[model samples]
Structures are given as structure tokens and as C-alpha cells.
Target: MPAPHGFEHLVRGDEIVILHHGVRAATLRGAKAADFLARIDTEDPQLLMARLTGNYRRGNERAARRHPRNQS
Candidate 1:
């Protein structure tokens, strides 16, 4: 089956990680994995974190860019 949306993994040495955007949302031990999965799958988490950090701009697509690698 396909992996859930917004779920991604990383491997380094002996550990594995799950991330949402660049945030370290979970590890193999699964402490906050449920909340992280729920948060990312159901919400615009990059936008959410931007809002929380007072970095959200109203209707600002410029921040998301238009380059192929940076496009939303």
C-alpha cells in the first residue's frame, strides 16, 4: 500500500526518522508519531508553523516560490 500523505522517512546510521517538511516529527520509537501524523495529514503544517511563529503572511505565495524544486 502507498504510504500516507505527508509521511516521509530518513535514515542515518542506526536510527530512522519521520519528518513533516523539515521538522523532525517522529522517530522509530513512536512517541509523538500519532500526533505528528494526524497534524500533517490533516493540516497545512508548514503554514501552521509559520502562523505559530508569527511568520505567516496573508496571501503570500512569494514565500513559496516558483522554482521547480521550491514550488508548492
Candidate 2:
């Protein structure tokens, strides 16, 4: 089967992969397989990287403090 909408197909070595919005979705060996499955699925890579790097915006600290879960 073909890849899903908004996905681009690519081949690396002996593996076939799908990229969704510039992020890796899945990879399969060989080229005779069906549709690829999403592995490291994510919506926004930038936001994910920002969160990982502890780069939240200035006001976000206050907002987090206001939340009940962050009180501790």
C-alpha cells in the first residue's frame, strides 16, 4: 500500500521510511511490504524539542506555577 496523506516516502540503505511533516514516522526493510506504521509519532517537532531542552517561554513559568500539579 501507499503511504498516508501528508507523508513523504524515502529509502535509506535497505530500509524504507516515511516522513510526516519533516519527522520520521516509520521504517521497513525491503520494498515489497505494505503500508508503513508510525513509530515515533509526534505533531510538532519544534515544540517537542523546546520542551526537552527546558526552553519554555518566560510567561510559561508563571502559568505552570498557577497550575495545581506544579504547586509541588
Candidate 3:
């Protein structure tokens, strides 16, 4: 997928606050926060933030489930 837009992160002491479209999405703490900080510089920041906030799944999951290809 194309790199997501409108995703941002903020570091607050021991916490990393993930935001999507100017709204709070997820909060990473301790190890998670550290890990995110480590990877943020090396990877696609927007995509990483989207995944961290569990916002990567943007398609219609319910429709995909009902598609003929998905039928048992």
C-alpha cells in the first residue's frame, strides 16, 4: 500500500503517543516505545505509525469475507 499520510508521533518522557489525522490512536510505553524510536529513523515513519496504531487495515474486511473467493 502507498505510504499513509496524516500520521504522526510524539514522545512524552517514557511514552510514545501515536496520532492519526490529528487524533490520538495508540500509546506505546517502555519497550514498545523504545523499539518504535529505534525503527522510526530507518523505516517509513508514516506506515510504521499506521501499523503501530492498528490503522493499517483500511479496506473493507467484511466485504472481502463475503467475496466468492473467500468461500469455503
Top-TM-score structure, candidate number? 3
| CA lDDT of every candidate | 0.51, 0.49, 0.89
Q: Against the true structure, candidate 3 has what lDDT?
A: 0.89
Error of 2 at 4 (Å): 5.2
Off by over 4 Å in 3: 58-72
**After superposing candidate 1, which stretches have Cα over 4 Å from the reference?**
1-3, 29-72
Worst-scoring 10-residue span by lDDT in model 2: 31-40
Task: Write model 3 residue lDDT over 1-72, tens digit each, in one string.
Answer: 456889988889899888888899999999999999999999999989988887897778879999999999
lDDT by residue (tens digit), candidate 1, 1-72: 222344355555444465666677645434344444456568775554443334444654765586578855
Point out the higher-scoring one by lDDT: 1 or 3.
3
Best by lDDT: 3
Instruction: Tell me each candidate's TM-score.
Output: 0.31, 0.35, 0.79
- Candidate 2, residue 33: Cα displacement in angstroms equals 4.5
